[model samples]
Target: MPHSVHTRSDTVQPRPAAAASRGRWTYRLGRWLGIDVYVHATFLALLAFFGLRAGLSGGAGAGLEQVAWMVALFGSVVLHEYGHALAARSFGIGTQDITLYPIGGVARLNAMPRSPGAELIVAAAGPLVNMALAFVFALGHTLSADAGQGAFNAAGELAWPLQFAVMNLGLGIFNLVPAFPMDGGRILRALLATLGNRVRATVWAARVGRVLALGFVVAGLFGNPMLMLLGAFVWFGAGAEAGAAVREEQLLGASVQQAMSRRFLTLSPWTQLGELAQRELDMTLLEDGVFPVESGGAVVGIVTAEALRDGLHDLGPKGYVADVMTRDILCVRPSDELSGTLRALHGRTLAAAPVVMAGRLVGMLTPRGVAAFMGGPQLRHA
Candidate 1:
């Protein structure tokens, strides 16, 4: 249940190393428990707010202590994610990385294991980590109090150690809530998955998550702002999960030919860049660029704006397309399964791939094309 509402395996797919560069700061924290972890840049902003609030209300000492506690809390969160990563790894699933955002943490893995038992273990492991941490803190509190240690209190009544221990225990319990994007929701899905289709279970759980998100939002109206933000996150995250499930379902039995753009334009490798650019500028067609249909009249390569830009920097716009065209191309047959094609898309660094049938270019498949299909094109027609 601890790993339930945070279920976001769909948004993950292999992407360019350059995209990872955007999360460079996220990687700076280095690795923990042999798993790479990146905390987002916005987390620093949160720290600033934490410091500012502590300064205003409790002075430097109190502010610094709160910051320290927050850091420790996040440390616990990272370990909680590692619980998921470790359990998944034990099942032969590979984790991408665990990225910590202001809201919570995300452990990106390659794919869900087929076994419901394995999925259940991976999902349950996260909450166990939280509970473990709470117990450790509670034990420490007992030891410290017994040693006649001074209570960390602002007033006569508040016991800081006990309060901290109790808060962690409450957090551990709250995370077990049976709602999608939370641990309980995942438990529901895993249990249901054993009875029916995994997709169907996900759909039902996601609906529950959405309902929970709405409830949180309504409750936040008279309560904490943090709960309101968490509510919004849950609302959007649930919708995204459902949308992804629907998209995958739509692509299940199709082929590249069904989704590819048939309006593909071809270019000669020997064609000058200036000429190609002029031609593209003058054309009424939505010509992004052209693929090189090889010297033997077979699809061989693709030349994009990036290729053209590299050419322009080296030999001006007069540079031939062949000079900049990428010969290391990946293509797929029109009859290839859409699921396989999507997997290929994730594997390749290219933004688009040329669709070939019997060595002839037929259509083009790009990320944008995929989006267009999902957004406007009728999947039923395909």
Candidate 2:
């Protein structure tokens, strides 16, 4: 299968604007192997709420112990996601990052292999890692002779290794349940793909996933609120996965040249920010607009309307376009395919990207341009 992602270097990429802002609410624990691990704000809330509850029920020591147990449990989750990331890496795929939520952990891969064998291996890796951990803990339990004494209790009185063993075993088994966006679901899809088309296999798998999700909802109503939330996550995730698969299939046939805007507004390097702001206010609503900065008939950089406005308050509107524009401009060739460019633009902060040919700006591809290509109105009014 053809890949759509390309890596420039090993240099770490800063979080896209949205993720950077989300950082105000989340805690980044650390990074390893080029993968930044983040703890979502909600996960922290979980720790606080559970710790407080445990403290009120028992004492301060109980609170601390509960929090420590949570840390250890989430550590296993991190390891589980890394299992997937490393396996995907073996296939030459890149993982953007790994994030841990109260529900679970996710490793965001650049792309999944369309090949069934590759998919099976990547899907199975997470559970296999958990199973391996479970085995190691079981061996520890045997060696330490703590297996029969207080295993799988939430209280600190139980042996930690036994707690790890039980949790890992349960996690490995639970993940094997047939459901979309889960390891077992991927395995099912891979097996189904072996018989025929991938899209068709995805549709069938999604259908089964939805049915199983409904079962989860029913079980959650009678069992646990956590199970209900898990059901909703699986429900939405399965539907989203199906939609993404279809979009990727359509994008595989699209070319950027067919959708790029040949005419667009451009600013000179020496253009004052005041002039740019006046031009923007004189034109249509430019809140979400981005303009190319050109010099000597070549695209030099890109500037955003928000960035210009923000610079005005600091620089008194006298700054040149050169001072405001981003020099690290990312451009796509006119002939580049839609899927690949889309991959490049994913999670990026830029308002628009230049379409260059032979180092000359031929056009631009904005969010509107992409929307137009994706079957919406062709908004080319420059």
RMSD of each: 4.8, 6.6
lDDT string, candidate 1, 91-178, tens digits: 8877767777777877876665656778788888888888887788777777767565555554664476666666667767877776
Every candidate's lDDT: 0.70, 0.74
Tens-digit per-residue lDDT, 195-264, candidate 2: 9788888888888888888988899899976777777767876776766565555567788887677767
The TM-scores, one per candidate, come to 0.80, 0.73
**Worst ten in a row by lDDT for model 2:** 1-10
Residue 304 alpha-carbon offset, candidate 1, angstroms: 2.7
Best by TM-score: 1
